[model samples]
Target: AFILGFALKDILANFFSGLVLLIDTPFSFGDVVALSDGSRAVIKKIGLRVTTMYLIDSHSEIYIPNANFQGENIINLSRPTSHYYYTISIPIKGDVDPARAISLMEKVVLAHPDTMGELEGKLEAIDNYYGHSGSGVKQKLKREVGRMRLLAEQDVTRMLLKIEMSLKQLSEF
Candidate 1:
């Protein structure tokens, strides 16, 4: 009985610690997290001594040890507050006004309903002459991609709901 109690106590401790870590950590549910070995997963649940994550490309669940979580650098792609940045680059090869291009891209990003309130967008130009043969006109665009990613979330959920409904309808048919 005493051994069982000790095991239970340890489990409880780990469980609460996991909860605390989940709340305090940068990552949250549905956020893409990169592990140390370059493996990436979407957070499903933060469990005791284990975090349930789904591999982004494979759509498979991966139980990551909590101990490893502390040592590894976790890149959280989603957080309510601004934590990550996404960039879209457009290369122009001619007598193109880089500033104007940036402005246009910025406007397009801001105009999107998904990007309007949640994320802030910035545009900059990088003249890459040394690295490449041609003068690389790179427009640096930054925004919290996860803010707009919620739209994808909603769309996926809506799609699943639609599939379920269709299945039900077909069953009746």
Candidate 2:
């Protein structure tokens, strides 16, 4: 009995940890999360004892035991919003006007329809982006991105609701 109990200890811990995760639902399927090790991955599946993840940096699948997963500090990047802001550093020469360079870079960045800017300005900049030739293509790309974001959000919400209902049913048992 002692050997059997010792053998089952880790398994039982993992099982309970997974159950708590299901109840809490910190992240849903397809949500990108940063682990304690500073690695980022997308949640693929949550099983009773293990969670499957796709590592974004390496493009590999990893199955993490639920107990260890629960112990790690994780940040959900896909929750609430998926807009990831990044910084880029540019070196300017002594002869270049810093103010003018900065202004031009800002305009270039804001010209992309996917960036955060006034809707009218972004739409207007599409003409500048493609020399006024691919305006229709730019508009279509923007619409597609918007639709994908909406669908991802809806999927997360739906999954959360289903998890909540399933937990409620389990509690009654």
What's each prediction's TM-score? 0.43, 0.52
Cα lDDT over the full model 1: 0.57
Clashing pairs in 2: none
**For residues 72-151, what per-residue lDDT tens digits would candidate 2 score against the true structure?**
89998765443657888777899998899877676666565445565556545544552232346567666556545445
Which candidate wins on lDDT?
2
Best by TM-score: 2
Could you give candidate 1's per-residue lDDT for residues 1-173 as a string of tens digits?
99998878756666666655644555655677777768778888766567889997788898866655555677664443445457766788679888887665656555433332322231111111111233334412212333335455555446556766776799998
Q: lDDT (CA) for every model shown?
A: 0.57, 0.73
Error of 2 at 83 (Å): 14
The superposed Cα distance between candidate 1 and the true structure at residue 160, in angstroms, equals 27
